[model samples]
Target chain A: MTKIVVLVKQVPDTNAKIVVSGDRVDLSAVKKVMSPYDEFAVETALRHRDASGGEVIALTLGGAGADKVLKDAKAIGVDHIVRIDCEEELDSNSLQSALASTLQEMGAEIVYCGKSAADTGAGSTGPGVAERLGWASASNVTSVGFDGGLTVVAPSDGGNARMSVNTPAVITCDKGDIKVRKPNVKGIMQAKKAQVEVKTAAIQPSSVTIVAHSMPPAKPAGKSYEGGAAAAEVANLLRDEANVI
Target chain B: MTELIVIAEIAKGTIHTTTSELVTAANALGGSPIIIVPCTDASVADAAGTIAGASKVIAAKSDAFAHYDAAAWAEALDAVAPQGTILTSATPQSKDLAARLAARRNLSVVQDVVAISQNQLTSPVYSGKAMQTVAISGPAVVSVRANVFDAAPSTGSNEISVVDTTGNMATAVQEFMARASQRLDVAEANIIISGGRGMGSPDNFVHLEAIADTLGAAVGASRAAVDTWEAIPHSMQVGQTGKTVNPNLYIAVGISGAIQHLAGMRSSKYIVAINKDADAPIFQHADYGIVATWEEALPVLQSTLAGMMA
Candidate 1:
């Protein structure tokens, strides 16, 4: 059977207000959920496994709190789930290295992940993993199909490119017609009993270091206009003050 | 002297505007700036040589580079780039190439950097909620956001040096397709007119396209519009899950400001929001907000912009 792995990350809800204090971003009060885009990734992997007769394994690298996303993945029909236990933050290089090694050991032929983590928004892990494994990769993939061969549709500039890559490849999922299905009552019950396999990974040394953090300069207060007649005034401001006209 | 290398971006035999911006960025650091033009054609390299602020242009040409392949480009760049800082415009291709190069060199990539100094770089983290300043210990790869830096003036005495590849390519492009002519990418557009779900239907996007054409702007969309309508592709999506746009002017029509959407465009220099709901969240971030429906405001705004431009 084709072995597939989907990488998911737990991130603060998109609407949470991020508070940056000193050198760290304070997220103690935020509600954590599966990174929004990872939903599409999980759905994509399950579809691929169902079509090709494979076992879909969901993997996540985070602290113990990340088990919430793993159970959620199990409820969504992932065959197996594993979590790499780590508390300290791992940079992209270290994270990708750990994932590449783990996926290699699992003999995974196909790997799926979100294009970028919502928290860091680095958008590098998928491609970095591909490079580490010496495999072909595609990013921002909107669709995947199995028509005698695996075909992926990706958006490029203003057009779309339908691409086909060899196996042992990494594909980053983007939103498309695939609406992530909700877990049914039975699925939720099954997920509650699912056992999450925990594993330890050797953290790699980081090459880049963050020295400090600061808030972006706040935007000036907005000017509100009342009616359609305000169009002329807005245009005048665009031309005179904003100089964009 | 520290040798700062810039990977010049070439499209359809011409240097992209972002390459000159990278040159300007490279000039900010105290070093001898050089441009690396990796292309199949030599004329594109000659075009890159004319860019200002660069001391020399190294054109790495090979048949393997006839199309855009990140692995091949990264290999060519690794071969030509000296032991110093490497910079490129933060496009989809560049991001992939930078990541590959960083992994190959055991270095870290600072993606979508907005500000840079000799040793320190500042970039948006957590989808623009906060900015992080990182210190580079030695050689590193950096991808810069387009249109953030001024394009360098064309007055350089740079010479072009040609190098042939060894034909050791791991990946090949089966085909390359270009976008429609005159369509600007949201990331590089100076002005953008974006529609949201409040516009109600896919047919109403024509209103945004009309205004975009009038203002020479690109047409963008919030994630809601893209998810709701088949006509709006993911490429037009501007949000945390989509492309982050830093256009000079961003005009939102009928968009309720979601934090995810704001994360992509909150850095726009000026914002104008139009929504029928007076209490829409978009008005909070907009510089000038119109408390009217797009149907009531777009036509008048379009005619007024047409008159102004005409």
Candidate 2:
């Protein structure tokens, strides 16, 4: 059976009001859920597993808040799950190292992750893991498939490029892919008993640090260009003022 | 002085316009900056020479480095920026690479920054949901979004020393494809005119395009407009997580002005909003507000302005 691993992150929902307190996200009123992009990764893995008959493993590193995501993954058809609950929040480098070690522990023919976590919008975990593990990786992929090895559709400078690669590779799923499917009633029932192993990360010397964070400035009030001829005023603003041509 | 490393991206074998903006930003931080050139293209190296504030330029050449790969970049950065902080544009490619690099270093990745200094950093949180002020606690890696800072004029002689650092990483770039566009980038445009869902159909965009053509300005859209309207190009998307712009004048038509959409163009010196709804959110941000149908309003503005131009 082809062995596949998908990296998942539990994040705040898209519509939630995130309070930026200092450099950290103020989670006081936020409701945590599986990051939306990870759903694409999980969907891609399950689709591949369904088509080629493989064992799909879901992996994550976070505090206890990530349990729901693992459960959601199992309900959605992941065969196995690993929850690496770290003592400290693993930065991207430490997370990559830990994931490399995890991938070594659970050898797989392919690995997948979301292009970015919506909450943080970091867009780094997949590439970090791929680099640390010395695996070839592709990111911002809108579509993915395994023909001889791997074929993915990714955003290029102007349009999309279909990329082909071999196995033992990493692919980060981007937006515009098919929306992820919800878990069926039977799958949800089975997910309750799915094997979940929690491990603590062991790594040192994380290079990145979040020193602070802030919100964007308020825009000055707006002035409307009414009527069909408003386009002319717009033209004037663009030429004489904005110079954005 | 501590060494500052700036990852200057070159698209299609040439230095991107954002490179000058970033180098100028680094100069404001009071340092001779180091530029990292990932591709083997010689013209890109020459363009780095034009960045008047740099002390050194490190060129890493490889087939694999040409494509935008965060993994390949992490390895390259590991080789060059082991002890120093890695800085990049807050673009999609750079955001991914910087975050992953920061994670590998076990440092926090600060993103979407509008302002940066030695002690304090300003970035948009919640996808332009709100602005937050952060302080650096450690030697951290940072990714700054384009248009966050004023372009700093070049001040030094055009001397560049090249360093090679591709030996540490063992990967090659398979390919690179550039996004094609004839209009100016939203971030680079001095004036921008945007349409919202209220523009109706893709066919109606010709009017907006005509205005844009007249002013020689770039056209943009909110997320809703991009998703629903066929008129706007994908490259002209401006929203919370989309391109950030700082034009001198911004004109919005039929847009209600959600906070997320406004954040992208809020930096524009002048803002004009046009909407039929008296209570449109856009009116809250517009310096000039006209409450009328875009179809009706646009023609009046066009004729009135055309008469003035004539």
Candidate 3:
């Protein structure tokens, strides 16, 4: 059986009215959900588990609030979970180390994660983990399937770049693969009873940290270009005025 | 004076344009750069010799070192950094290498750093949302985001010193599948028109395509736009991890600029946003914004520009 670990994060649900105060994400009015891309990892894991007959484990470096997302994962068919809960504010570097240690402890055969965190967009964590663990890794993968070995389809310049790679590798899912299927009412209730294990981070002393946060400046009002000759005016505005063309 | 190590990334047997740019930045600091090359392929080594200001070019050639691998590179760089600042391009592979090497060696790693003075350096925070200058001390490994600095002209006849790293690496690059050959990357385009999920369907992009063709602009997409895979290709995605661009003009259609998406294009000189909803985050950074559906705005704007050009 192939042991698969999907690294998921608990993020504010869709349509959450975001209020950013400094580096903290204001989650007062928002409910937590599994990060969108990480859902792809879970989906891929379940698919692998169904075919390969191994356990699928959901993992995250989050706080107690992360349990909600784990429940969601359990409803979707993940068999095991590990929440490395810590208040030390681990960046991608620290998270990578902790994940490496965790995966080594579990002896998982494969690892998967979203290309980047929706909130941080660091995109470095997954690849960083693979590097620390001495495993092959690929990002922006559009498709995947296991045939004797794992074959990952990565979108390159325009077309897809497919490579049949070995196990003990890390792959990050991009958007637009298959959307996550909603858990049935029965599945949700069953998931509420699933077991969850929490762990603490093992590394400290990060090289990067969030210094502060600020909103981007407002865009200027757009002027509507009327019909006919105005098209030429718009063209000129785009070329000579905006110097974009 | 401290010694500096520069890994001059050469692709397809030639030095990337940013090679000279990095050397120019390194020259301002205290150290004389010791150039490191993973592949000692003759053509790339000869090209390395032409970089104007480098003190010495160190070349390591092998099939294992041909393609960019973060693990192998980090290990190799760790051995080379005992001397000076180990500077690398902020390209995808370079960032990974720098981060892994720094983490492995427990050395200080500064990434996407734009300008470096003697003690203070400027780096973009929140994906170019704002620039922060910080003071630093000690042995540092830094990766420079290529576009942030000017591509220094290659004019000097610097000396080339080749080094052997044939047996130094254990990890091998089996193969490489690069897709950047098809579409114009955001980094290189002067004009870009981006779409979001609000554009609705893939066919709707044709309207924006007409305008882009008229203006000779490239097509781009937000992560949401790319989510509709049928409409936009993944290559054109402009966002935090996707691609960072500084185009002359950027037109965002039906896009509710998420902070992640904005991080990719906020540096454009002029930004125009078209969205039915005025409250979109994109409008906050636009030079011009129109609260109109793309279906209505795109055709009208395209025809208007076409007629005016005629």
Model 3 DockQ reads 0.23
Model 2: lDDT of residue B172: 33
**lDDT tens digits, residue span A104-145, model 3:** 898888888886565544456666777678777766566777
What is the Å distance of residue A195 in model 1 from its true position?
A: 2.7
Q: What are the DockQ scores of the candidates, in order?
A: 0.53, 0.42, 0.23
Query: For every model in order, what is the iRMS?
Result: 2.6, 4.6, 5.1
Which candidate should be chosen as best, given DockQ against the real structure?
Answer: 1
Native-to-model Cα distance after best TM-score fit, residue B174 in candidate 1, in Å: 6.2
Give the DockQ (C-alpha) for candidate 2: 0.42
Candidate 2 CAPRI grade:
acceptable
Candidate 2 on B150-234: residue-level lDDT in tens? 6545555565545455533322334544556566567556678888888887677777777667666778888888878554655
**TM-score of chain B only, all predictions?**
0.90, 0.78, 0.76
Over the true interface residues, superposed, what is the Cα RMSD of model 1?
2.6
Tens digits of per-residue lDDT, candidate 3, B1-310, equal: 6677777866556677777778777776765577777674744766767676678776655554654545556665565455556788876566666666665654556666777778556666545654545555555667776655665556656666555553233223233466544445665566888888988887777776787777667788898888666547766889864666767788898789887787788877788888788678787777666677776677777876677667
For candidate 1 chain A, the 10 contiguous residues with the lowest summed lDDT are A155-164
Each candidate structure's TM-score, on Cα atoms with residue i matched to residue i, is: 0.91, 0.83, 0.78
- Looking at model 1, give its docking quality level: medium
